[model samples]
Target: MTAISDRPQMLPEQFEEFARHLGRTVEGIRLEFINGKLGIKPVPDGDHGRIIQWLNRICIQARPELYVHDQGLKIQGYRGGFARPDGTLADADAFVGRGDWATTEDVLMVAAVTSFDSETDRRDRVEKPRAYAEASIPVYLLIDRDSAEVVVHSQPDGVRYESVRILPFGKAVHLPEPVGISLDTEPLKNWVR
Candidate 1:
């Protein structure tokens, strides 16, 4: 009989170090700090950019007294360092400075529009959620272009997130406390194709 693989997987810390080292050498590409590890993601496709633009427009239409970062915003965790969510919404005063905008306590929601490989999917689906949860950033949204789905996670429990909800295209997902906005994905479907 063939033996099944039983090798131990690398720890989060080890991955973190590798990611950090790679990030230092790499340029142009966007990298996120996940659980002390570095996660490099693609520059995003047209569909992803379209969705982000749609969300930004919606937020502007609503005008909820929140600060929205389409692509240039960076969110930093206590131990992990920094991550740039595709679209982040927080209190207007949460972001400060010109060249380098630092995240503050007023920040609440962080969202990433996913359109990359499996490793990036795992980072966005699992690692980033935990990182954002630990940072106590009320809401974390993951928009998957492949499946045309939006996953909203709220209620951070320790280093993980809870109350996870998956909303497919054509549906609307309402963000919970900290961010009381309803995100309609119906319009986003047009951008996917």
Candidate 2:
């Protein structure tokens, strides 16, 4: 067998340094600080944008008080996981300045449209939800292109969500009280490979 992978694990402070480096070098493509490691992801594609727009429209319709931000959500906890979801719903007041991410406490929900990339798939389904929960963000929405389905994760307990609801493509998924309107998922059909 080949030698074990030698990618050095990044310490917390080191992760912070890397974040700064990314800021200076890569402008549009954001990196993830996940479970003490820095992860690089591909820029969103056309299909990804469609899903993001769909989610944003439904979010505003359901709760006018919430702002649907495309990317730019950072969880403020010791573990240091950074999330730039395809779409994030936060209380109107959460957006204060020119920063990339908003405060985790003020966030209502986060949503990501899965890319064709496998690394991104794992982050969207597993790592991101866990990190968002750990920061106590209330809801996690995942539109998985691989399975052609949507999953709503709620009742977060730091490491995971206690409740999970999955729905196949073209079916509407109901968000909780704060977001009273349902997401019309028919557009998901157009996200062709």
Candidate 3:
């Protein structure tokens, strides 16, 4: 008589090899796995790139704890899920002994400069905010090129944030305690979208 086998037919580890293979071939597009689903983000436009650059410089200057990370951006989530924000601010100490990604534990905020495309706009304003909140990133700073405004979202609870503050170009918006950044908006006003 043939013996019955107890081992599972397909182990979970088998699938990631396929994903890794797919990831290697993609170019210019950003890929993420959020809550077990795939998310694709297009390359930022020229204006978006400038906005990200400005945010990086100003944030690092404002706080010693903040740094500009250009690549390999991710916030760790369950079951190998990761989300890549355009730019990010995390405690400088958090990078110790890690590779490939950054955890949300020490992430003070995530930054995104919205695209002119409608689908991209929704992804930035809606889907990303929820994902960031779920990862427990304390703040989300969104520069809406469409509206010529900056919005700060903080105090995440579940899939939503408790605080949503909007500031038009040339208006001062406090980044709140912990981050505690007081940004001068004059340059942002001068920024041409």
Q: Which stretches of candidate 3 lie over 4 Å from their true place?
A: 1-23, 71-80, 190-192
- Candidate 1 lDDT over 103-168, as tens digits, reads 535667888877667786677777678777877878888887778888989998767787899989
Report model 3's TM-score to 2 decimal places: 0.78
lDDT of 2 by residue, 33-109 (tens): 77666777878888888777777777777677777776466676545657677777876667778376556766778
Model 1 ranges off by over 4 Å: 1-27, 70-79, 98-101
Score every model by TM-score.
Answer: 0.76, 0.86, 0.78
Give the range where candidate 3 is weakest over 10 consecutive residues by summed lDDT: 6-15
Write the number of the candidate with greater TM-score, choosing between 1 and 2.
2
Compare the candidates by lDDT and give the number of the best one. Answer: 2
Per-model lDDT: 0.69, 0.75, 0.70
Q: Report how far off residue 67 is in candidate 2 (Å).
A: 1.8
After best superposition, candidate 3 residue 73: deviation in angstroms?
5.7
Best first by lDDT, ranked: 2, 3, 1
